[model samples]
Target: MDSLDLEVLTRARAWLDDGHRVMLATVVRTWGSSPRPPGALLALRDDGRAVGSVSGGCIEDDLIYRLQRDGMPESPQHVSYGVGAEDARRFGLPCGGTMELVLEPLRDAAPLDALLARLAAGELVERRLDIASGRSTLAAAHPEQGTAFDGETLTSVFGPRYRLLLIGAGQLSASLARIAQGLDFAVTICDPREEYREEWNIPGTTLTREMPDDVVTAMRPDARMAVVALTHDPKLDDLALMEALRSPAFYVAALGSRRNNAARRERLREFDLNAEQVAALRGPAGLYIGSRTPGEIAVSIAAELVAVKNGVAAERVLKVATAKAALDIAADTLSACATR
Candidate 1:
């Protein structure tokens, strides 16, 4: 879930506690292009007040208008928009776009409280809502499952925030952590080097004085996790990469030049990592953007990480070195043409 949906839950729970009736709206399906994805949340109060978003703006406005005029429905209901071009224009949906939403009136606090507590505890919970019976239940969400809606029931998975484990406590690590936090990742910086660890101070990320490899072992990185080696020291980055590359981390990368990363892979093969496992390492990490500053480097890396996390094809990604070289040649040709 994104931060928007989490904010919706927080706001909805507050309204429920204040004796205000709240309606929870979830985007369960979308056709063509959508401003938000499935599982996007919106919490609407009995009054016109609201939090979160289902569409860009117009959809929320229409929802608020409906609630204000027609009042909250007694049971869960289904609402859709953009069936026609006129409706699409009115709701600000993109041309040919459509959305299906599940609106559930909330009066009970027990389930909400339980769901919030479970999420806070870092547990993945599946929220099941039966449309006909207007009943809801929570269960442990499986690792590979995602939000699903059939004709009868809606299953929304709420889990702990995705995590990014950085095997360094330096300027690049700090920059990357800051950016990753914005993307709603629970970030951790691990460094056994006392000097580096002592000098580090980032607000949201956890700075641990543990061995990088040990930290990776403890994390038990799953598919939702990312492990990045940034320290550049073999003693620190190598073992961590060895563990991470073998694990199920969605993105496992190291900060190094092309030559160094290649050498690192060869070294990892000596440590019993197979050719395929070492091949999984994304070194010279981040897109090729000719980044010189730490912050720029972080942005380039974070962009690539986001692409991989979204399952973008590697072939389509723009590598910095190649891209920069190509652009430089183009600029030179343009300069020659202008001179002539």
Candidate 2:
């Protein structure tokens, strides 16, 4: 679930508490090229105000216009948009796109409060709503579960969808954390060095002064998690890599030059990790973007991480080491010709 949806729920609860009628809308399904995915949320108040999005903007406008003219529904109702070409154009949906939404009139905010509390406690929750009665229930959810609708009930997964453990507290890490958060990743920065730990002031990130290896072990990285080592200190980066590579983390990477990464791999092999685990380490992390500055490098690394998370084919991505080596060979050829 997106953090923005949480904001919608928060605002909805607040509006209800303030004696205003609130209508919560959830996109239950989408057919083709939709701007927002299923489980996206929008909250509408009685006074034709909204807090989220369904389509681009026209859909929200229509909803607001309906609310002012028709008032809130007595129970949950299913509303759809873009069933025909004319409707698609009118609602600003892409050609042939269709989306179904469930709009529930808010009579109580207890469920929203409960859901938000679970999310704050870092627990994955599934909110189930009955379309007929406008009643809902919350339950513990597994990480693999996603939003599902069976025509009568809507089950939406909400909580942190992805986690990122960054083993550094430097400028590059700061930039990466901001990007990751924007990508809906819960970020944690770990650095034992007092000098580096003291300087980390990035908001919306958990800073830890514990050893990187210990932090990695505690995180027990799963498939939805990524572990990145950016401190460039072998004692720190190598230790974290040894543990992260052994876990199911979808992306385990370290920041370094190609030569440094090669050496780091050799050092990792000396640990308890097997050959395959050592091979899993992505050194010189990021795509071949020719990035030089800290911010550019962070973007490159974030791009690669997203690619890996999305299951992009390896052959489709150009690694930094591969591209840099090719560039080096081309430079050497040019130098030899000049000398000739």
Candidate 3:
């Protein structure tokens, strides 16, 4: 269950290695209610076979219909969909949504291979979309690199982002890690306790006996990645959170009760975290579910994690996912995806 972007890139690399011409399309910008967001990617083969998506069926059908027979233009071209009055009517644009795409046929070998290699290593590299000159450059914060693109005029679009992380090895950790794995997170479960560590059997998760703090410090989580402490142990949860707040991990939370979570935060104030960092603690952990069991708690927590990761405010998402039975579906869905 790799991300749609990863799957597209993987297939693109295979095609490139096969010595087949590949046309790449990325949604540079979107407005209103487009089917795909700004970074949506679609690869056009020399023939007609295509994987990945730019739209829900209709837009892809339109794209395939327009470019499949032309067999990918030799020069890079920029195109838009659901724009203006007539095109919007014709395409059935939802609420007047518009999207622009960049179409570049496989021409240069240097950049494509470099990007593929970085992606294979699971690095979050930024590809700057220069609409004016129809050129893009890949930028990564590396030891040998400190570069920026300022010459862009029309618009710039970011490339595919990275995944999420989970710390702790209990059932809730297992369940959340499993679901996050499908969401294209390179999830890892860090639990030093033997009772919990022995039950670590989730697929696509790298389980470690090393303490959570050391492991997180070693990996260095980023804004694209998130950390959720499922252990509820102050020793494990607090130490890992100390490191998580200092890093760029976009989301950080722990499973705990109101009193327990309050205590956890009060203790961390001694570690010199600011009010902002301390305020980031999410608990009554997860959306309030009245969950009396482990699995239900996992769903409530995971749903909150998803909302936070997606940049949706907790208030907006909790309403939809508050049902006890909904948690079961989420837990089961996560189980199915990771196990398979």
Candidate 4:
């Protein structure tokens, strides 16, 4: 999935180089309740096919209509919408605030290619737009200063997806790792036990047997990173969880039954972690799935992780109860009925 996105941009760059018209759109500003936040991207093709999005379906719809209906500007340009109350009503902006967009036709992929290379190297890149001339320049984004959007320059952070280090290689780990991968998280599975470690394999994921704590120190999980203890072993799970909790990793969780989870929390308190540090741990780690198998348990955990990453309520994520789980539930119902 990560490669697919990169490929799309690469194709866009190709189109630009071939002298086919193309335009880049960025959501520079948003009002209350905008569909997408600032820094969202939408690329336009001369033929009107687009990659990525910067607004609700409505905005994309309008942009496509305009592109196909009328060719892009002869030269690169920046467009603004929803600034005035009247424009907001017409565009259906959330709260009638203004948003600016940089719509540049790429004549050279050099700029974008260079920026992408820097970003891939984990170097923060800040894209600066010169409003009057409509030229864009990319530079390193400062750690202290996040990307910003002004009418003149719209700065965006690229190649900064959050990461997840799942401790323990098991069915649950595989499931959770796949989910994390789909969510654009760089995931690694760490298990010291050889038995489980041997079976550890998932596409687009790294499997390692390094001490979970050591891995934690190395990843340097930022606010964007999360550490999940899928292994039930305290020796393995505890140290990993401890290291992660001590750092800036925003989310840390452990998998266990509710009873076990409570006990685990208690143990953390004995480790000199203040109530807050211990409090950060979410045990019984998944949303209740009433799961009985490893696969279902993994799905449950993965769904909860995505919810945390997206800041969406767990209840809000759509869950499809598996046929097996549904059948099991039905069978239980019939058994109870027969007993009655």
Choose the strongest candidate by TM-score: 2
What is each predicted model's overall lDDT from 0 to 1?
0.88, 0.90, 0.70, 0.74
Stretches off by above 4 angstroms in model 1 are 94-97, 198-207, 324-340
Give lDDT: candidate 4, residue 11: 70
- The lowest-lDDT stretch of 10 consecutive residues in candidate 4 is 317-326
- What is the per-residue lDDT of model 4 for residues 247-285, given as tens digits with 9 covering 90 to 100? 998789998765676788888888879889987887767
Report the number of the highest-lDDT candidate: 2
Over the stretch 1-340, how does candidate 3's per-residue lDDT look in tens digits?
A: 1377767877887887887878877776777777776667788777766888887767677777877666678666778787777777777675466877777776555666777677666565666655455566776643222223233422322233444556677777777776666566777778889988897888646788898899889988777777788776788878988888888787777766556777888898999899888887665667765766777777777677777777896556653224434677899999999999
Candidate 1 residues 227-340, lDDT tens each?
Answer: 999988999999999999889999999998777888998899999888899889888888987799999999999999999989899789996645756898999999999999
Indicate the TM-score of model 3.
0.71
For candidate 1, which ten residues in a row score worst on lDDT? 319-328
